[model samples]
Target: MRIALAQINPVVGDLLGNADRIHAALAATEVNGKVSADLLVTPELSLWGYPPRDLLFSAAHLEQQQQALDQLQQRLHAEQLDVALLVGVAEVAPDQQHPRLFNALALVQARGWQVVARKQLLPSYDVFDETRYFRASSSPSTLSLRVNNRDWQLGLSICEDLWVDEELHGQRLVGPDPIASLIPERLDALINCSASPFSRRKGTLRHELAARAAERLQCPVVYVNQVGGNDELIFDGASFVIAPGDDTPLLQLPEFAVSTEVWTAASSTDRLEQPSRAHQQANTPDDDLEALFRGLVTGVKDYATKCGFKAALLGLSGGIDSALVAVIAAAALGPDHVQSLLMPSPWSSSGSIADALALATRLGIASQIVPIQTLMEGFEATLTPALNAEPSGITAENLQSRIRGTLLMAMANQQGQLLLSTGNKSELAVGYCTLYGDMNGGLAVIGDLYKSTVFALCHWLDSPDAGACRAELGLGGSGPLIGQAILEKPPSAELRPDQKDSDSLPDYERLDPLLMDLIEQRMSGEQLIGAGHDPDDVKRIERLFRRAEFKRRQAPPLLKVSKQAFGSGWRLPIAAI
Candidate 1:
């Protein structure tokens, strides 16, 4: 059977727009007034986009989805297309229950569309609240298709349905195994439509899951994923098809982009052979750094574009974090559209200022120097009367950061640009960053990346391995984009004289691992100590992390790139110990 995987990017709540995208995909995959493939599949909830959240609660939104599906059917019939299209939709439950919706797939032909498959495993973990929005299906869904004078039994599964291996995930969802259910059906091929978000090395896990399912069913497995950024979630559509018994994929789609390609499976009577090593090498998974860079670029670009902003503004402090954000902004929105303000305070080193300017020059992005020394004196003068003393120590230091943040926001507002926050995960985790100061922006570009990860990504960006990626991202020049000076310089806020991050917090080399354990692994102080972390250091870091909940709660939404990020996934009580 010939199947076309439509790896598409859908805008949330833009029902007609998404349908138009599907229509365009159909047109692109056609040959002389007929679709070349026997079936076309789109990602989960392709009609409404993924994680519509509260948008699902609106009756008008659901009605609009039905209208969009009707329009797509009409277009297909009007165009005389002869292919069965599998598009994701939210099926209204007939029983009119509390949730009243099922995350489902609709089989669209020229005449009309019908809901064929409903998702069974509704994930409620980490950034996903599927249980709150959708009711699970009790049984597996299967479809019998007649193509090319032959019968094919196709198994249908949604995003989380294929993730049933306990060994791979360390734990399994408590429900019927979708893969095991299909084993009794003797399926010809399995298709998983998903809107899985991007996380480091998640593509590997996806491949393993698909490969295992294919092996168990003794058939080929096709995985199609949604691509683009929706709010804090960024979906990396690394869609692929894996033949049974082979861990390597026979066909692989590009990551972090929209693509549609047709894959032809061998007849049921014949065995599906694995692809040659040369082909396998060509379709190998991307380097983690490359995926990380592309994911951030996609997040920034989509967030700005979807939110109706053409330009971006950020405070470029010569520090590595800000420097990386500047580069990402330039790549996402063209360098011409990304502007930066070098808000140098009295404590800002001349070398740092020069380095910031040089890096901006290399990137071809516009930069402006906004000195804040005069503003600092004005603030002290204004507040001294009420306090009977000048703001000193941490208060004075935070004043500098706030001053810079205010300038960036003003410029962004005046120019109608999106403001990008440059704080990294480590600073945000330990409350090393100032709330309403460095945390001020429409989106936090690197808030999910640890300090160590930020440094590593920068180093990779400078290396030759990133050449192809840089070219694809339209980053100019072959020379190092981030200078050695910025990479080698110690991390500092520059709010105080010679302010080093290490002065208040442990070294990032030690702190990031502990933070990862505490946050992502959810390790307690005792567990951390048992794992060989210093008891005193663990206690101090844990206290800091817990105390920073209030600040994180007030911070702007950050792009999610890790398994756990501070955005929607990290749920903790602010009043707790």
Candidate 2:
């Protein structure tokens, strides 16, 4: 039997649009007249979209979804298509209070939807709070049918249902295997509908888990995932099929696009194809650098599109931070809408301006050279008396950065473009970045990536056919968009004349790991020092990280690409030390 799997991305609460898109994919399959196909399946919550969030309580959202389902039933009957449809949507039960809704999947035949499988497992762990809305199904559901005049049995499962082997108990962890129960079922295949979120290296874990289950059940498994950028989450849509024997991968689909493939029971015996290597498709394996790039692109595109802004503005220091942000902005909103500003002070190096201009030329982005010497002088004259007793310390240095930042924000205000901040994770972690200066912006492009990772991504973008657009500035060659000097030169804040970043902080190789431990892992100083770091170095790094909390707190929301990031996930006291 030929089964058509529709891989699609749907917007939350847009029931009509989501249903229309589903019908369109179904129509494409119908044009072929079902042929030998007997079933068509779509991703989880494809009807109302995934994580309807609080919209589940809205009277309009629930009403529209139910109405859409009814309309779809009429269409199915009117078309007289014999194909059976399996889909996911939100359903409200008879309970009058305290969330009577459920995350459910429905099987619709020519007559009507005969079976409804409510989600048996509600996820309530890091980044998931399904327990706040859904209730677990008390029993299992099976779909029994006949295709090609033959009988077939299939078991139903949702996203969190397969991952219930682990649990939480206050501050401790618990274990109970959920997939184990489903493994003993006597069935021909198990079909899973999911709205899984994208993370680094998630595809591998997903494949391994499904393959193990298929082997245990001795049946082929079809896994479908939702794709698209929904607010803070991005679903890497790479749905595939895995057979039990030899665990051959029958098929693999594309990412960030909607496509359908036929999964034949006969082809399941014909030849199972080998799994493709990482980087074979547009986005997989979630390479740290590649994932960082995609996250930045998505953040920029969404921030711009949602806020109704068409252009972005940023001050371009000859340093790596601004250069990286510029390239990301160009890739996101296109070169035509991104602008680079070079606001050099008296201390600014000629090489810095040249490098900034060169990069702007390479990316075909417009640039304006605004000199800030007079502005800096005015601020110094006004604040010198108050600063003379303390001498030139952090305050004086911060004034210079604030001047440049003010200039960039002014440009953005005048042109109605969103300002992009260029501070990176390393500088932001050590309190080295100037608050209200370089930290002012709507969204952070690479806030989740460390400095070393940033350098790696810059080099990666220069490679051939890595999806980077050609340089239109006539600088020659389509090599990576960032200037070569930016990658090789030592990182610097450039607050004063020739100030290198390493002069104060440890080398990024040492700094990033410490920052990762402190910020991402939330490891204490004693624990980190026990891990072979120098005591003095650990104390200094800890001090920097703790002091910088105030800066990060006021900074723009970071785009999360790691298991742990600075904002909402990592909660700690700034004065804990």
Measured by lDDT, the strongest candidate is 1
| Model 1 TM-score, all chains together | 0.98
Candidate 1 C-alpha lDDT tens digits along 30-71: 667667888999999998888789999988988899899899
Alpha-carbon RMSD, candidate 1: 1.6
* Number of colliding residue pairs in each model: 0, 0
Candidate 1: segments with Cα more than 4 A from true spot: 32-34, 273-285
The residue pairs found clashing in candidate 1 are none
In candidate 2, what are the lDDT values of residues 353-410, reduced to their tens digit? Answer: 8888988988888999988788878887877787664326688788888888888888
List the candidates' TM-scores in order: 0.98, 0.86
lDDT of each: 0.90, 0.73
